[model samples]
Target: MFISFEGIDGSGKSTQARMLADALREAGHDVVLTREPGGSPGAEEIRRLVLEGDPDRWSAETEILLFTAARRDHLERVIEPALASGKVVICDRFADSTRMYQGLSRGDLRAVVDQLHSLMIKREPDLTILIDIDPATGLSRAKGRQGTEERFEDFGLGLQEKMRAGFLALSKEFAPRFRVIDGARDPQRVAQDVLETVQAELPG
Candidate 1:
């Protein structure tokens, strides 16, 4: 199965992705754990350009192009091959993020994102686990990380609020494969829920 985790920054999606991968590995499953924008070599280079530097470094349209470029490289080099080999692929973030961060952050150009996605990258994960959390808390946690990838976080609370709403809307928009999980609880509790949800989806 192909699984992708989505959420605001510091929503614990990354940690949960890692935990799920580890759990699946422990259960004797062949898993390929990866993350977008930095999964493949080419994507990694693009990740730096898009994620680091100033928030205004690239406009939403420009960011859409850059992110799509990175995603295409990631899909070609990492995701597709692993799935073809029957290994479970778990990605930290995917195209939905592009749909939110760039598509809605500045304006309502979801059509552009969808159009480009249909044209360039036509793949979607079998399951998308959204870690739902409050914007204020998520931002606080994200800021605590103090990482170089603060370009998005630098947008501050207002942007985070918008992102939270956008992601929730996405969860509804893609209801079938999207699982909304509360991320405010303890990590282990959240991981257990995530694992169970995923296990239910895993092919026999």
Candidate 2:
């Protein structure tokens, strides 16, 4: 199973992704936990360029292409091999993130989506879990965490709101493959929701 978790910063996707992988392992399944833009070494370097660099350095189109490049590396090096081994691959984020962050915020949805589709014909996740949260609250949570702000994380609330809306719109368009979870809830509750969703989606 290939599952990707999506959400704004501070939405606890990383935490829950780990938790889900642990649970799956306990259930006797082989699992690989990873994150986008930085799963493999080359991709990690690309991640720093894309996320930590000056926001003004890259145009929206450039940002989208860079992300897709990182994803291509990640898929070739990590995601595909693990899936071929019959392991569950739980990724922190995937193509949906680019659609939300660049497409919605930058006002070039079709171009970004088309480019991504061209690069990654097998890019779609089997199950996508979008953790929904208010941008203000989510930002506050992010502030409490220990890390320098990435370019995308530094985007304003308006952009994050638009990104959230974009995720919702995509979820509506792909109901069978998307699961939108409430991130405002307690972590355990949110994890439970994700667990249920994954259980329903994964084959026996």
Highest lDDT against the true fold, candidate = 1
lDDT for residue 63 in candidate 2, whole number 0-100 = 81
Report backbone clashes per prediction.
Answer: 0, 0
Segments of candidate 1 deviating more than 4 angstroms: none
- Model 1, position 176, has a per-residue lDDT of 95
CA deviation > 4 Å runs, candidate 2: none
Task: Put down candidate 2 lDDT per residue, 17-114, tens digits, no spaces.
Answer: 99899888888889999998789999999988877757677888878888888888999999999999999999999988887777778776756566
Q: RMSDs, each prediction?
A: 0.6, 1.4
Which pairs, if any, clash in model 2? none
